[model samples]
Target: MDWGSTPHSSTMYIWHLEGLKKMDLRLRAFLAPLLFCLGFIPLWGIDIQALVQEQVKSAGLADQLVSVTNQMLEGAIDTGKNYQQVKQLDKLYQETKNLKAILNPNKGASKPTGLGAVFKKAIEPPVDLDKALNLTNALQKEVKNANQDGLDYSKILSVLNQLENSLQTALDLKSQWLDTRKAN
Candidate 1:
């Protein structure tokens, strides 16, 4: 029953083993790069998140956004201005969040896929990079309308400046990411 007993069968068995060895080598060659990229995704997320946080803190929005919003809420302010501040702050926060979502999409939110996603994109329009910069374009006018004991329009402007810087950093990172993808 041993193939080695016959020269013809032994030769056939040797060829079969050689074929398997070649196939194993090819599979390893293909999987090495795939596995490396798979392992890289989580590391990329952490690094990108850290970079964003660092940029946000450096731009000065990390704490000021919250503190300014709190002070405006507690202090007495004109009703109309109060409402305006609320609206503007909400928009700023939402825009900031959306930018972050764009950066490392795999980490935070899951986007829709397939035909539904295409339809949504068609209706909503693509993300406007200029939108973040324009968020506080009217702050100078708001500052002129400020009064004491009301919303600190000057401080609001300052915090928004930080928001602008943070957004700019995000935009820059996104550009780099796009370039890398294109090159790859």
Candidate 2:
């Protein structure tokens, strides 16, 4: 069979090209308004770099809290247990308070306050917002319990570990989100 003599093949090829052209037109038509609406809407329009930086700062503060708590635990083990525990509990309280202030600057305050408060205002919530909040609250309660009874150092340490984990998780999620957004 001679290739040029096949009229049916030429017709089929023309039909395929026509079909592709139609599909291309339909896709463009569907995407035009969607792209336009996306342009008008601001979803992740905030400066993600700033948000990531804030999360990093929060994570650093949480790390400090963890370090101090570990020191306190060592002190309790080596020195006067009750006195050392009380002092460490106070320090933990202050560090956790600062962490909370960083996490939720608007809480119990007239307005945002901190180095990254303005950026925090615009930043979207991390994937683990609820988890972070609950863990932070649990940490506070554990600190309160430790302060009141001066018992169960193990329990306090466990709660501090959980809080630090949550903070680190949030920081990781936020950083990943920022990296993805930047790549796009």
Candidate 3:
């Protein structure tokens, strides 16, 4: 015996397909925010600066580590002695490039050692204040070394701006974390 669809059953099946499609769309819409909250997407106070710094230090490229940190601090300041602007994507790109040693005082074979390799390392989150300070001091050394002839005032300014921006971002993160906690 053949089980065939009646006219009424065919119409019901078409409606069921349409309903499934609508349900699929609605399900996607509902999941968007849920996934975002679970960190699949960015939320308020997301700090890319911290992520950059973590990667820089983990690479242990030493020289690039310092340069990147300095640039982050400086970029923060340039953003209006404010922290949010420090993580500006353009500024981050410029500093990341500098940290990677793509732009350097030396040319070709003369380029600073380990600059490129540093970026290859995966970033690790800071474990303590001592580690953070060590990173800061190392960055200072790189600036001093790079400026033996005369400091690049422009570079200094940019770094200062980035630093300020990073600090602001950190503060913003803290505030948001607190707010979330309170709400919860």
Against the true structure, whose lDDT is highest? 2
Full-model lDDT for every candidate: 0.58, 0.62, 0.47
Ranking by TM-score: 1, 2, 3
Q: Which has the greatest TM-score?
A: 1
lDDT of 3 at 97: 43
Model 3 Cα lDDT, one tens digit per residue, 36-143: 788843544354545445434333443444465566456545655433344443344454445444222232442333855454333322323233334434444545
Candidate 2 residue-wise lDDT, 49-150, digit = tens = 545565565555555565666666665657556775667566665666566555655556455578567776677354345555566666666566655453
Model 1 CA deviation exceeding 4 Å by range: 1-8, 25-74, 77-127, 148-155, 181-184
lDDT of 1 at 182: 80
Residue 116 in model 3: lDDT: 56
Model 2 weakest lDDT span, ten residues long = 124-133
Misplaced by over 4 Å in model 2 are 1-82, 111-120, 123-150
Tens-place lDDT per residue, model 1, 93-177, is: 4544444443323433346799977775576533344554554444434445544344445676777676666667666766666
> Global CA lDDT of candidate 3, please?
0.47
Q: What is every candidate's alpha-carbon RMSD to the true fold?
A: 7.5, 13.8, 14.5
TM-score each candidate.
Answer: 0.47, 0.39, 0.29
